[model samples]
Target: EPLPYSAILQPGHTLGMMGGGQLGRMFCHAAQSLGYKVVVLEPTEESPAGRVAEYEVVSAYDDMKGLDTLLSYTQAVTTEFENVPAASLKYLSSQIRISPSAAVVAVVQDRIAEKTFIASQGIPVAPYAEIRTIEDLEKADNTLFPAILKAARLGYDGKGQARVKSVAEAVEAFKSFGEVPCVLEAMLPLKKEVSVVMARGFDGKIALFPIGVNTHINGILSSSVVGVEEIDPTIEKAAQEAAIKIALGLNYFGVMCVEFFILEDNRLVANEIAPRPHNSGHYTMNACLSSQFEQQVRVLAGMPLGSTDLLAPTIMLNILGDSWFAHGGEQAIEPDWASVLALPGVNLHLYGKAEARKGRKMGHINIVNKDPQQLIYYARQVSDILH
Candidate 1:
């Protein structure tokens, strides 16, 4: 598993990215900057990456003609989102090399499967059960009452989860959620949410990014202040070790995100994993020695992984779709645009999207400093403007 410089690709080669959202947009910029060409495989005519990348194929990832075109033009393939269909990845793998493997997609796509695999690996996860039917739900222990129920597939931004007060509430919640199979879990009184973002090189080497302290509004991530607070050295080590284990086990060869819930008791519970660059990691664009997107391109391009150290204490605030709406003719999400621009060490990245719906991530801003209080103050300053 040494660095596969001969077997893997390098800068100046084209990477086919299978998604065209903001993540892909930043990825396109990163790859292009690293001397790698980029081709976006997206169905959206106005995809953000299509606007930024060198070339784009306007077809679904599952389309064979599109896949053929992607493989013919690109040296390797990667994805911006973890939920990209495993079948589509398998098809692409037949024609071109794919990093992170389709099996990683298959596992991370479903909550039940992901938790099961993590638990099997002796990783800590919340007490949970998969419910495919009323009977399955009924089997949930009463001790696990007041649980968080989430759809097994396509759940993001708090879009497909509900909190149930009781077993009776679980039944109604399931019915309201179309009665599909889902994950029901005991709700932990989380002290805070944190995330660890890392990249694994083609040689099976792992690079751990600075941890992010995340804040969510209504179960949807709103802002992330980098680095956790009051963390035991052992807990920090455990989090990194857990990430290395999962990424290596899944044969992942690119950037990945692992979110954790730190309970009041100081135990770290693995909340979920994203086998791609994550929203929380956006702070790295300005604060990390190597941006996650750039590091990802390097990893997939046969280069050694770069440093994961933070350049400064960073504060990142997300501009959700609500920010795009005009309120009294003002951008609702404007994070003190002029004030932020005036502040030193502040950087802005806007995703070129035509339209924004409620709760959709529109863009992000990062502020760097040495003081955590100053970082949080500036973060709140921005969040207040946008929120």
Candidate 2:
């Protein structure tokens, strides 16, 4: 159980964060804006969040000394990424108030458990089979072919996944993945990819932002657009309802993003759930009354949930490190920020990473306008400059 709202919300109270990625960096900004100090626990030195946090505990996720040090600094904690060791979160939860609890993280971090849990809640997920050994792959259903074999853990951004058309291919891929536990999911005809970002409070209140129409390039999220006109009304309502159902089922207590696949038949199939504020929800930073990161802080601090109203039709473009090599050179060249900035309704946010590598998420640009068409127009202009 978490501490009471009054105990956690005292002025100048420090909060602890579990990861130091770009998400943590934005989370630090939100926490600071709310008059709370942040401490980050990350093994890496000079991590994005570490740079912004008031203190950084330099230790591995499961390091007891580091966890102890973090507990000493803050009574409330939250994780920036789901991959953090569940044991570490469990240990921390014993001493401090943690949102989305260790149990939730444990369930969502593994593909097998996550899919099973979602389906058990009466939510629709793509047909999938668990592959723990070679026999499991051989015995998988024939209809599951033309499917994606994904490692059950530590896979993200197109990694640890392969498309297989037969049991032989699946076996090969499974061996290549070091025979790890995996899930074989049937691929569906996806008409569109959409996601809903919602925040649930300790009081069981849920606030969902508008659904984001998403696109992917090289299996990585390329862009997400949120607007009243972008999604069908029926699809939007179903997506929101499914998201709320999953939150309630998990008893989730933080900002979570549920990505869904809208099929050609207009059926909504849940793809996956991110236990933390997600990349797709980054648009909320500039277009909503409260950003997802701020909502995360509110949940962690036991504060009342904030409004999730969208203030404008917005498009968020992910700026990958590939942009730096657009000219094809050994040295990375910066994109023309002047041109991108000159465009109306362009909100540029660059993650302060020291180096640029292809496919790395350097930052994002949020283009907002009253006209939906203009939002799309501005997004293309920004892409032209960045690419």
Candidate 3:
């Protein structure tokens, strides 16, 4: 049996993390500040997380020797992204405790599996069907027209997806993906998109942050605003309850973000689940009593989950790589950070990435003020300058 929560991981113990992206970077900072050592396994040179960690294996996720080395230094392991192979976690779990175990990761790694699992739990999900062979596409219901065909695995940031209005179009899009597994989801008339970020502890207790109202551009999250507009109390309650149910059902032991789509009729349908800390939750880093990253560390360390009260009604803007390129998309030029930072109440966080490519997530900025409208306006002004 795994160790109990009473034996919480001590402050000086080390933690191993898979993936060295911004999520892992933030987790590392949180862990380090709490007096834990972090070891990162990432192939990218000078990865965002690795740069801050005490040790980085700098190898592929499946590197056997590197995995062993990471395990040698840490008491527990966790991942930063769902795309990390489930088998990798499984391999590591044999020797160490890993939160949001490989089994949980496997379920959300594929869109079809994710939706199916959610629906099986009596949770609503956007109507979707699995598509692998062309025959499956041929048999798809005509009602699913104007669907989005997305790769079942490894799709993120609006990549590996295509809009299909007909069976022929879906076939073409599937072929473009080399006939990889895909999911066809009927588009819904969305009233708004929202997400709930929460953490489950080793003892099965749960803590939830407030639901965030989100806006996306080209399927990439652009901004997350909380408390800017009044959400129906019923809808907010349902979203929060459903989020907790999902985490409990998974017996998840770390922070997870569940995205939901609120229809015009005020119904809530789960869109997708990320099995780790998410971009939408970045606002919590500065706006909440305890940030999501801090929650992640606490959970993995078998420590009690912390309070998630919102400290301020806030707006968070994602800084994408497009902001680095000129307005016409001709060449790369850094945005005027001096002017952007000059704006009061702006908290800027730039990932120490060496290069910026179009559509890449570079960093984010959070604006917090007691007045929600003013927060949104200031956030927009700063985003406009950055863009």
Candidate 4:
């Protein structure tokens, strides 16, 4: 049952966030904008969200003292990343409200469990086989070769994954990962990738944002373009419905994302689920009537969900740490932000990270315009400027 509004919706009340990355930073901004105070629980001394939050609990995720401190301050809590210890969420849920409960996070954090859950929902997922031991790898069917061997846990941003063409290669990769549990997924025909970002309320109401056509470079999302011209109406609706079905299946609350692989035949296969606001949905900050972060805040506070209507054609470009050294230098050099900002319809957002390392997500740019073509053109210009 949902908590009474008086318990959480009161102005100046505190909210809790687990994980202090860019997503939590944005969630803090949204919560504060709605007259709420946010306290972040992250072990890092300096974090993107910690720097902006009203308070910071600098302790490990499972630290009892830390959780108690956070609980003492906030009536509700939400996680910024899926990898946050599910035990920590479960502990908190015994007291305060936690969105996307520990049970939901537990399922999504492991690739094997996540894939099985999606397939069980009657959703189409890529052909995959679970590999927990050398024997399991040997037993894997030859037809599933030319597959990606992914760690079932603690893998993200293209990490903990390897592409193999044979069972021998898969065995070697499995051994390389300390024989940890993994999933071998068959490679599919080439086509496009897309994602749907939606927010589900405690009342079972859901609001979905527009489908984002995503492009990934080296396993990291490079850009996401959302516009009527970017995808067929039928595919968009199908993706949204599948995402909603998954959210319902999980009995989820707060924001979540469902990534889809659109095959060459135009069939949509569920790739994975993100149990929080996703990077692909960053365009919502500038393009939609209500940003995903704001929706997260509303749901946590027991407030009504906000409108997700797209206000304009938008393109989101990820800014990696590589950009800081794009000028061929051992020392990092700042990109020409002045040139990029000079372009009309360009909105820049930089996460408050202290250092820039190759492959690190430092920030993002959202380009919005009424004309879809112009938006893409602006995105290209911004990409050129950043590179």
- For model 4 the local lDDT of residue 77 reads 91
356, model 1: CA deviation in Å? Answer: 3.1
Report the error of model 3 at residue 307, Å: 1.3
TM-score of 3: 0.97
Model 2 lDDT, residue 259, Cα: 95
- What does candidate 4's lDDT look like per residue over 207-299, in tens digits? 999888899999999998888455878988989988988999999988999999999999989999999999999999999999999999999
* Candidate 1 similarity to native, TM-score: 0.94
- lDDT per residue for candidate 1 within 76-148, as digits (tens), equals 7889987788999887776666776798899999999999988877899999989999988888898888898
lDDT, residue 165, model 2: 92
* C-alpha lDDT (0 to 100) for residue 185 of candidate 2: 96
Identify the runs in model 1 with alpha carbons over 4 angstroms from their true place: 1-6, 325-336
Write model 2 residue lDDT over 279-350, tens digit each, in one string.
999999999999999999998888887889989999999999999999988799999999999999999998
The candidate with the higher TM-score, 1 or 4, is 4
> Lowest-scoring 10 consecutive residues by lDDT in candidate 3?
1-10
Clashing pairs in 3: none
